[model samples]
Target chain A: MRDFDLLQPQHLSDALDALAQNDSAIRPLAGGTDMLVDIRAQRAKPDVLVSLQNISELRGITRENGTLKIGAATTIAEFLKHPELTKHDALRYAAYVFANPMIRNSATIGGNIGSASPAGDMLPPLLALDAHIELVSKNEARVMPLSDFFLGPRKTAKRANELITSIQLPVISYQSPVSSLQSPVSSAFYKLGLRQADAISLISVAVWIQRDGEKIRDVRIALGAVAPRPMRAIRAEEILRGEIFNEMNLKESARIASEECSPIDDLRASANYRRRMIAVYVRRMLEQAWSKTQ
Target chain B: MQKKTILFSLNGEPREWSVYPNELLLNVLREQEFLTGTKYGCGIGECGACTVHINGEPILSCLTLAIACEGKEILTIEGLAREGKLDPVQIAFLDQTAFQCGFCTPDMILMTRALLNEIPNPTEEQVRDYLRGNLCRCTGYASIMRAALDASVLNAHRSVQSNEE
Candidate 1:
């Protein structure tokens, strides 16, 4: 890696100041699992690195008002250990299959989102959860839906001078008017990689659903590694939102999801294969999530 | 970039070292500190040859900047043994002949120690999952698995003996 000045900031405001410097080459250093690899490969070169490792503000997981507030610097290992995450299968499963134990110890949630890779393991699950990211600058702070954050592969809506502070996931609950009936809300994630560990996804899917009797009260499906960015199957979700949860509708929604994605032929997998697997995994994930609601 | 002095605990020893901003912890340990047991296989963090414990958790040293070690406790393979006696995990690896090329042994041992620390009696599936990142290119995983199980028993025996004492 090329030599660069390292600025270790103890406070979030100081880190923001360092990033808001006149030079656009200044980059915020989070876990360094992704950025360091990119730098060694010459894919990213920054003249200055603002280390956020010492910032206590960006390292925690908390819940308030039925929303999970995850500090941007929280590592994947932390997610695996957190008690609250176990209730959300999609996010926890994504955390479970993310790289390996060694990488998870150092890879932070913010870095995963900041890198903005289409195959990032956390993106599809977060999209399914309807996560909102909080970005902070020296002068201002803003919140935006994760769906609007990614523009393309390794691209995001974050400004050069801003830093992602935390990710907020709303704790969605479904209630039945009749006390005797049961309402279930569940989410599931699946990743197809070449190997069991440390392999990037060929295609991945996440599904979140609320079951109201025989009909789907609400649903969201997210796909990864099959587009320029991790994306939602909006049309397929629209079809299933109020429809009966049945095999025919599930197959139709999965087919629509496969058609919605625009994947390219990559070294790991062909575009045709990815589209086919997308249909299979989408259907499987939807089934898995729906089964949990039962 | 100017060189900066960092203070951290290495192998239970307090040390201060000067490093450039971009210098990786793997290089500093191998070159400056002369603790070369940590091998460099894939500098991109894919290979676990450079694994070390930062604050008791195993992490990739090649991808970690040396400056980041300031005020942190780092445990490398050189630190795994106490006073020239091998750790239980190390003894198990030697007894089981867990490696062939031995290029990935240091990281494998470190990761095994970390896993055993977390799960004293981990199942075979758990052991495989935990050590999945530490790849043995010689494909000597069967022996490695045996060594991990043996180490768990050895660790338990040692703990029981120490408790009796």
Candidate 2:
């Protein structure tokens, strides 16, 4: 760690003001987990570090009108404990399996989103749930859908002067009595890694299904770590909507899902292996999602 | 970089200090307070050696900025014992032979304490899930799990005896 100017803003306004002042060289740090790792690797060298830890407003979990708002500075550890998120069983399970306890406690939703890595553990769940993000600057604030947030791997629509305030997620009602085949939503997200606990996903998928009896409704599937960004398999999703929910439908969906991805094989796995895993995960996750409704 | 002075309670006593802008809580503990009990085996967050209780939650000190300590209470491994008496988790670790090289003991003890705090009577699998972050290099995890279970049993026994009286 080189000698750097640390700015600990006591309030949200102050933090944004500081960012405005040091717009060129300042990087907002909610938790040093990602920033420090990047700094040590010499990948990032910000002359001024904008520390958001002291900004109390940035740490909380709240819900209003069936919308869940998670503060950007809130740690993943904190996110895992939120009763609202836990109620969303699939998202909570993904959060639990993300990384070690230490990383969870020290890493932030903002940082994870900031990294914009295709392998970001929380993004798929948020994307599948149709989450919205709020970004702030010294003089302005804007909210955008998660789909519009990412530009590429490690890139986003955010300007240098801006900072993420919180992420808001629309809550889905799962308590209503509905037939498994006719439920409004049947969805699941799966990540395949080398082992289980902490390894990065070689491939992953997020599938949300709408059902009308044995006939499928609008279906959305998102895959991650296979492209520059986590991508919605729109073609595959198109292939499934209004289709019959059966083994044949699942097989067709899986094939479309595999071919829809633009995965490149690195040392972690080969492109061919990723395509196969994508198909396997698509079927497995979709079945599990349907089973939950049943 | 600019600097700030923070005052917070450490263990049971209040302490005030100033830290450099880039100083992490782990470095401050190791260098300033001379609390080597909190090991810094991995600068990265993967290892649990730098684990500490930040306001009762286990957070990696290495990844936490020292400036964040402005008003929060911190409990390191040294704070576990009170009045020179070993905490039950600490005693259980030794009784169940939970360490080989003794390097990961502090982190293991603290994590076990945190786990028991949340789930007073944790099952084997629950214990393992929480301990996934705390890796013991000497491969002393079997006894560590045994020790956590033993601590739970000891608490049950103590409660039963007290109830009988």
Residue B142 shift from truth in candidate 1, angstroms: 0.7
Q: Give candidate 2's whole-model lDDT.
A: 0.83
Q: B41-123, model 2: which lDDT tens digit per residue?
A: 87878788999998898988888778778888999999999889777788888899899999999999999888888888999
Predictions in order: chain A TM-score: 0.96, 0.92
Model 2 residue A52 lDDT score: 84
Q: Best TM-score goes to which candidate?
A: 1
- Clash number for each model: 0, 2
lDDT of 1 by residue, A1-294 (tens): 798899998999899888876466999999999999888888888999999999999988898998899999999998788897777899999999999898898899999999999999999999999999999998899999999999999999999999999999998555656652454888999999998888999999999998878899999999999999999999889889999999999999999999999999989999999999999999999999998775
Error of 2 at A132 (Å): 1.9
Predicted candidate 2: what Cα RMSD to the true structure? 2.5
Worst 10 residues of 2 chain A by lDDT: A174-183
Model 2: how far residue A235 lies from native, Å: 1.1
For each candidate, give its TM-score against the true structure: 0.97, 0.93
Model 1 residue pairs with clashes: none
Extract clashing residue pairs from model 2: A4-B1, A5-B1
